[model samples]
Target: MVLRFLFLFLVLLYSAKVNSQLLTDELARLNNLGAVFDDLNNDLKQAKKTKSISQTTMAHYNLAIFCSNHRVYTEALHQYNNTINLLEEKKNDTLYAKVLNQVGSIHLELRNYNYAKDYFIRSEKAAELIRDSVLLALATSNLGSCFEKQKKYKEALEYQNKSLQIFYKLNNDSGLAIVNESIGSIYEDLENYKLAELYFKKALKYNKNEKNSRLASIYNNLGDTYRKTNRLNIGLDYTNKALSTAVEIKNTLEVASAYKDISKSYNLIGDYKNAYTFLQSFLKVDTENKRLQSANQSNALQHIYNSKEKESQIQYLLQLNKANKSQKLVLVVLVFMVVVFGVVWYLYTLKKRRHISKELDFKQRILKIELDKKQAEEKNLQKQLHIKTASLSRYSLHLSQKNKMLSNLSLTLKNSLQRNNVDLKRKLTELIKEIDFNLAQEKEWDEFMAFFKEIHPNFINKISNAVTSKLSPAELRLCILLKLNLSSKEIASILRLTPDSVRVARYRLRKKLPIDSKEELSLYLMSF
Candidate 1:
């Protein structure tokens, strides 16, 4: 018992070790695939920057195919849409048809039948336009699958037959195998077990060289057909084979389908215990598949929402850019108008200032001419006053000499009469009295004074107001001579008096005037 228990423990440990190794190998393989995908993505970005649109489109299509095969359906759909958009812009019908077919397959997997049909139809049209036989075959096969999903077996068969003929013409063994499998699935849905078996066998023969998930699917279909026909042992063998292939390829959906078929076969053969065990296994795998499917669906929805948001943002930015350009145009026009107005105003002010400056210069020249004329008239008047003053001085000197000669002649006559006769003494006395009367007369003095007043208009009145007493006529005559800058001898000669008598009269005049002892009387009088 101890040895048996130890053996069982050893077996269990070996099984666990194998499972761990399998898991580790699977993880390493997936990591390597992810690294390859990253490299491809980098190459795609570089191609876009270089504006190699053809290379960019090819890279995106390749990545989409890779993701689709790996069951990364959301990423696969996104990449496929990107490829389609690029191909459309380039008008590359062949490539565009290929991408549309792949996109339809993805929508069919998601159970979006309407979307799948639309894409498939569009792809078929594009392929037909470009005469691409391989692409048209693929698109027709996918459209048949869509019809099969909808339970329209007649329509599905029609499209499948069309695809099969094209595949034959092109010698595409893989495409022929795919179409055969789709037709077999539609027959199975119609409950025609014999016909389904026949097509499944043909698909298996064609798929023999293709070591892929599609081979596992054909195996699963074959297992289902045999089970429906009551071939229990054959059905179990085929179902187990399908499970093995699915595990090797890591195709979870196919694996679950194989498990379900195995469980059904066991139940039909009266192996209730084994059937229950297989059913539990099927349930576990199916649950895990549903969980993964749910996650993929959620990711796909999120991707669609994000794409719509990006399109909205692009439209908003375009409108804003247009508004900015319009505002800039208006601003430029306003600035131009302001500059033109400023230039016009500056030119007007400059012209006005020039006219004002010319007018000012003309007025200045006229004033200068008037001032010169007044100066000339004043000079002539001064010359006339100087001549008149000189004439008055000469006349005063002549009167002084005539009075001295007359007095001397009268004295000589009086002396001769006294020596000759007493009778002649009375006549000589009368003659002396007549000569004195003529000498005392003021006719010449009056003429000289009148001439002085003409030249020195305010001289007499100004001197009288300045003196303390009123001036006699003799003093007035003396004051006028002093104002003319005359010497005391010249003044005495003009007055017909001796120089001593003239000095004595000036001293008396000085006492009556407001003059200091240090001031010359003639100079003081001339100041007036």
Candidate 2:
């Protein structure tokens, strides 16, 4: 009796230990899920504040998925409702269909068959509108699952086949695997074990490298088919594989289901002790999972309630702050208006002063231009006068040269006649008279006087007024040459006289002039 009691005590202790381990794992999973929801909630709040519709919708969808995974049905429904509302507002047909499909899945999980069917139908219509074959395939596959849950095998098979066709066309291996698994479940329900096994094998082939939960499900389902066909050893092998995968992923629900499947396989294979042990572990894990789920739901409800209360208080404080800012804005506006008016007046005055200064500058510029024009005109007149004086000096030298050449010719002719015959002497004398007339031509002297008068219009009048006595033509010519700054030798050449005679004439003229004895004759003539 003591040995039997101890054996019972050990079994009970083992069960309790498994329950504790399951509870601890479930709590850790819940905490992780809560962390994910917190991050998503914060993102949702920011997206709403910034008016980002797409980000807000995605946050809502992800939060719904998290709630669904934790079996928080009501909270999942609330988040999915928010996602659907935003998607409807944006009119995003493809994403809207996907959200509707997710909503259907949530309803399916809750066992609301009729509601799940309705949502799946709506999702199909939205997907069809956008011609999105992938979303349509998802909706169709979900509809098959809904029908399968309701025991409508024919309807489930039809929808699954339709979804299968789309998945083939799209080459969606994941969708194909899901549809095959559902079809296999439907066949298993109808007791067609061969067809069920065939589909399960196909699902396993397609589900290679899939998520741990999905692979675990496929292994568990395949093991069930093997057990139904009395292949107990093969069934136990698959079930053990499923349990290992489920435990590794920390999926408490799948772990419990795998343990139950493993226990059933052992029982069918005549391994009663292993079957009993696995069954106890399954019961312990399942019970702990349910308790954890209940606790998590309660915590989530309290958090939401607190958040709503805090939000209302924050809204009230924001309103008060907005009112205070409005009053400050009025004061700021008054100061800004005064500053703007002062700046405008200052700019106007500065512009007016600049305009007046510019006008004065313009007048001064015009006056300077007129003065420059007058100076240029005077300079041009002086240049013309200098050119005329140089021409007259050149003409005087030419006339003197002509006179000396004629006198030399006359002397040569007279000498030639005296050496030849007395009769030719009379003819030579006539020729000499003609030469003298040419040498003293009044026309040449008049032309010289005209040029000199143009250069020095007031010079002759000034000299005549300065001198006490009237001046001879020769003396006047000497004074003009001296005014031109000609040397005594040049003056002698011009007057057709010897240099000594020109010097004597200059001395006589100096004595006649009313000037200082030390002053030069050229300087005196220039001043006059």
Candidate 3:
């Protein structure tokens, strides 16, 4: 039994040393004097790292805030103190002053009024060092809170008013919310419930986010005010409001207070069943609070245990140091080989990328050359098409002018026939018939259509597709003339038809097409 007991003791010691008592990395760094921590802490390594603080002050501050907000006051205090020590050089800094004020606040929460007052005074002095108005106001307000907790109403009021004025000038809602709540609490203690409610309401108005712990506190204070004023139902409502908010925030202290207040309010209202239910809840929270208090008491002993564990770690490191010499040499060789391989691999990849880039550039150059060749061919085709279109236009114009001359000559011969003998009349009649036959000839029109098709390859096909029905030969002739943008009179001369008849044919052609009636037939044909 004695041997077994010794064995168990050794196992416990070894396990404790190995586990480091579950110390967080930031906390462990804050504790040790050594630069080296463990294998995974290579990132923490630096020249003269031992002399400088291991954990950054900001890390400590954030951790402290998290712990404080979570009701892990012991860890919060530890982090806050170490952070202050690390920040000793900048005692006048705004963060230093803020941290000092926050430390006092934790003490205030713990009801250590003397220590709270001392820290608040230190915080206020630190703020004064830099003349930081905001920090000064915060420290002043916190000092007021500390004094208020101590029942020093006059001093509390003095400090609170000074902070309140600053908060108002800055238009800082959060600061206003906190200071106003503090003032309201003072008035409540003084038996001035009306004034307390007024300030509490002001605090609530300024506090935008309802989830805030400060909001819970203000509601709780307001409930107390109403309860003292004998407004039982109203008081119960506010207390329930506080309880809901405190529950949402998971603030153990405020939650406990809210539970207690509810029990008392139910008791006052003769709701014994509800009162009993709330009393049980309050007791449970109180038990948890007592446990936390016990944890707080054990925190000092835990700190000592950390020191011993750190010493053990140091001894373990020393033991490993003797064995690491050969291991380090092997590690160095492996690292050198890795670096050599990496360099070779990098050069190979760079060569591959350059090869790929050159291929891409060559392909791009080939593509650009092909694109330029296509563009030049298209430009040459456009020039050839334009010359063909001009030749077609000139041919159409020559036909139109020739028809006009033939019509005039036929009209003159008809008037000459009225003054002549039978032979001359008969000859004049034959000549007029020949002129009329030439004027009505389809050859010139057929040639114009053929030449037009070459210039505008798909025009006839597009027109056929667009027309509602198949066109007559005369209508097709009119379409070609319209495509050439010829006026109605010019088309009349070319087709050997009167201008009025040409206009009538154009209107009939428009009825067969898909174009709007308001649209010019010539312009519509030209679009195709």
Candidate 4:
């Protein structure tokens, strides 16, 4: 239960309360709700006082609907403006779109063409966003009405036909009635009375309500179309029916319209007496309507009571906004706190999880270090072994070259033995000296020394340090071979000399060293 409460609280903190379809349905039902101005005004004030935004919006919407229905356009326009203001910043797309359409309608009714078209376009976009076909159709129909009034017949028909198609597909009788009426008005304005009469009849056919003001309006339009088309008798007959229907519904505006249509129809038929009589009736009704509209302007109506209404309304709105400011701030602060708490809670849980894995992480790190140490030791041993193998191969190549040079010298000496005795002796002496010089200055010796130093990098330096005097290159070579622990015969063969001669060189090399004779020479050399 506690967990559930936390979840609910978080949900409330995060979620915005955009209005639902239920609010739209409620607003729709208010059109038929019979409430006077004073009652609706009271409802609006109470809703505003409570700071219930949805209720306030609905209240304003209801007031606007009633005012527009009663043809109190000034007040209706003001209320529609208020409704739009309240719904503008909301995420409630459906209700916002519907409200936009209503505001556009109010502007259209007032003949504020630019404002009406702008609002209709905005509503169209909002409808498209939510993919509401019904809202889309309604906005399209109103846009057609605006174009029609502006004398843009082509554009008016285009929009009207589009909306008509939508309404037909939806099978919406109300939408069909509205679109057909708009299309009829367009045709009527273009003086296409035949098409006008046809559409007006279609509008009547779709409209289920016979006693309503719309039926009276359709009758008036159809009658006017007939009067223009030279069917005066038929026009007079339909105009009388319009008057009857208007009188039945107590629609004062429609009654006035019917009277004017009848007067015009009578005039067209050359019936001056009937025309004059109906014209008088039309004038009386139209004058009374203007007077009543002027008289109806109260402190809230700007037509008569502009000053006090503006002052009081401004003051009331200021106080209402001031009161709402702190409430909104409080809500915002609460939301911020809840968000911060959630983040801190998440971090705390994450810390606990990290703590649980701490020992395992430490063990893994130790294993990684041990594996790295073994790998490093193995690499070091392999590198040393590779260096020794490379040194041995280089030394073997040097030995083979020396042996081949010695064999060439032996063959020359053997061949010289078959030459003339005197010349051969001279040649033998020169060749023997040259052979001895070449052995001392062996070309491969420098390269062998380089390879020997790689395998025993410090050997030559140690040999120099051991002897107080500088040794010849041959003595350095003797020290390196001793480090290799070669026998005397192997050293003699490598140097192209007798074993006894190699022993004499070794003895001479030892004499220049600082070591005791008791220490083994090869062992001493190997230490370096």
Candidates 1 and 3, the one with greater TM-score:
1
lDDT of 1 by residue, 1-528 (tens): 586346434533543354345446645655466466667766776888899988888888887886786677878888899898888765456788878888998999999999999999999999898889899899999999999988888999999999999998998889989999988988999999899999998999999887788899898898898888888778777887787777766676776787677778878987786677667766876775675566544543454355446657877899889889989998998899899989988998899899889988988998989889888888888888778878777766677677777768777976777675777887888888898888888887788778888888899889989989999988888888888777778777667778999989989999999999999998898788
The better-scoring model by TM-score among 2 and 3 is: 2
lDDT of 2 by residue, 98-122 (tens): 8888889888988998999999999
Q: What tens digits encode model 4's per-residue C-alpha lDDT throughout 244-264? A: 776666566787788788878
Q: What TM-score number comes out for model 1?
A: 0.52
Model 4's alpha-carbon lDDT is 0.77
lDDT of each candidate versus the true structure: 0.80, 0.83, 0.79, 0.77
Candidates 2 and 4, the one with greater TM-score: 2
What is the TM-score of each predicted model, taking all chains together?
0.52, 0.55, 0.47, 0.50
Error of 1 at 219 (Å): 1.7
Scored against the true structure, residue 500 in model 1 reaches a CA lDDT of 99
Best by TM-score: 2
Model number with the top lDDT: 2
The RMSD (Cα, Å) of candidate 3 is 24.6
Displacement of residue 257 (Cα, Å) in model 1 is 2.0
